[model samples]
Target: MGYGITLQVSGDYALFTRPEMKGERVSYDVMTPSAARGILEAILWKPAIKWIVDRITVLNRIDFESIRRNEVGSKIPPRNVTAAMGGAHVDLHQYPSEDRQQRASLVLRNVAYLIDAHFEMNPSKVGETDTPEKFYNMFLRRARQGQCFHNPYLGCREFAARFQLIDHTEQRLASHYADIEEMDLGWMLWDIEYGEERGKGKTMYSFQPKFYRTMMRNGVIEVSREVGL
Candidate 1:
């Protein structure tokens, strides 16, 4: 058996950057499954369980807004930190004045979504006393109280999201696109998978991003469980 939750998430701005648009940040037409899972983890995350987003309901009409800002182009290299950790003095400071670049972003505005998701316990990680009901109750209590490990963001950290846990029996409000039929969303990022057998006794440091072609049916998107590239 699986325990699921329905949460209402809203934000003033969101930037779910498209992978193809390297120069400028361009958002997808709707929220992606991975982003929905991130919001759930922000509320309550446990290594013993994995969250699966089942569906996403777009509550408000999709709106796009463009903006430009000064941003850092790159981050400090990890090798520099490694050298500093070994007692060698290294310059690890980032100079915003030097790295700052003007960037444009196409973002979503006044976005709201209802995310329905469930969690599955990992047999290898779950303790003997850990039960589905235990975790379900924990999330239920914390979410209802508006408690989260960190403030959930829409996509970028700058745009914070506000959430409310809806009772399972409560009537869900109709979506803004309820009257509309299906709309193709093209290929969207599903999630990233990390695990590759390198050589003997070597750590898996590489990852692969997965994607899928999907559509929104009357403002709702059903997340697929099938695994593929």
Candidate 2:
């Protein structure tokens, strides 16, 4: 366990796209744990520390809205990009007029959540001067001052998120959906686990996406350590 903090995040629209729906975009009812960690990292992150989401509190009703967005059908191939970078005269540009396609998306609207999380020091990346307390205090200061390395978004870059540190002393009321005792969120995407191995004096990295059966009780989703993150 490390120092813990609460952050309140709100956005007009959010799209935590479900992998099952390949063609159309459909968002989850609440923010994903990985997304919450990304928001915290955006505010303040260092290689020595990694954010762990303990729980999330939904502060607003989940509502979905349908919209159509213009998107490109395909992306420039890596081979073409490499050739262009090497001055081999390859066209790596994607013109909207030729590749434009409108896709329907079911996204969440007027969303707000309280993220309860903490940072754990990575011993492999920590230095002699790097301390958990130092990074924790730095995170608090930066979050309170409204500073972030980049603009934080709610799942999608276009749906910008606004965040603020929650004051523990301030009395706050429960959300409208707080009365609901329990709700099953089905299998939800947890996070991608990166594994690195060294063989033949070379290092190889692999990414594996993980999913867990998620449930919310009294408006709070408690992430379990037993899941092996």
Candidate 3:
């Protein structure tokens, strides 16, 4: 799964506009120490800016079964499917774990779907031939740069309080973070309540890449990167 960030700037911030997001506020979620340094330099950002994540949106939820089904009777040869399972079993742990590149390729194809869902890009262009490819490529390039947004809001699920118009389907995002310190580069942290008797522990953190792998395994996100990994 993927998440998005929106910032409500105070004194000074990495104030910029995402062209793709239609002039919405852009706050880069620094994934690495180097990228963090870059942001510090680019915006002359200081720790004193009262910098806090404004909001985060988990972008995609991939699953394995959906992917398997899409390939049921496709005309093209399945690039990664080694053995066809006839209503058998699907286990994601059986796949490679270390190479995020391979997993990224698979996850990015459906990124356009998430982008469309969140940004609401014109759907009329999906069949324009170059449109889908361009949309896919744009997100791929951004992720490769280790770029992401940090949301300071309570979490994706509770963020609707700030929205004037809310769509339940869009609320599919799992709230990952409760506060600002949980912010990390490209890593979206939110809160989740499991049972009526909420368990107690040092709150767990869920990584997006891993979530994406799960999604790929579950078939929520349809794109697959089987070759370059």
Which digits, one per residue and each the tens of the lDDT, describe model 2 over residues 64-125? 99999999899899879868877899887889999999999999999999999998999999
Residues 82-142 of candidate 3 have per-residue lDDT tens digits of 3343343434243223322211101111111111121223444334353434543443454
Order of candidates by TM-score, top first?
1, 2, 3
- Tens digit of per-residue lDDT, candidate 1, span 1-229: 4899999999999988899999999999888899999999999999899999999999999999999978998998988997998899999999999999999999999999999999999989999899999999999999999999999998899999999999979999899989889988899999998876768865457788999887789989999888456
On lDDT, the stronger of 1 and 2 is 1
lDDT of each: 0.92, 0.90, 0.25
TM-score of every candidate relative to the true structure: 0.94, 0.91, 0.17
Shift of residue 164 alpha carbon in model 1, Å: 0.3
Sequence-dependent TM-score of model 2: 0.91
Q: After superposition, which runs of candidate 3 have C-alpha atoms over 4 Å from their true positions?
A: 1-117, 125-127, 131-134, 146-229
Clashes of 2: 0
Q: Report the error of model 3 at residue 168, Å.
A: 22
Best by lDDT: 1
Instruction: Name the regions of candidate 2 deviating beyond 4 angstroms.
Output: 80-91, 198-204
Residue 196's lDDT in candidate 1: 69
Note the clash tally of each candidate: 0, 0, 35
Point to the candidate with the largest TM-score.
1
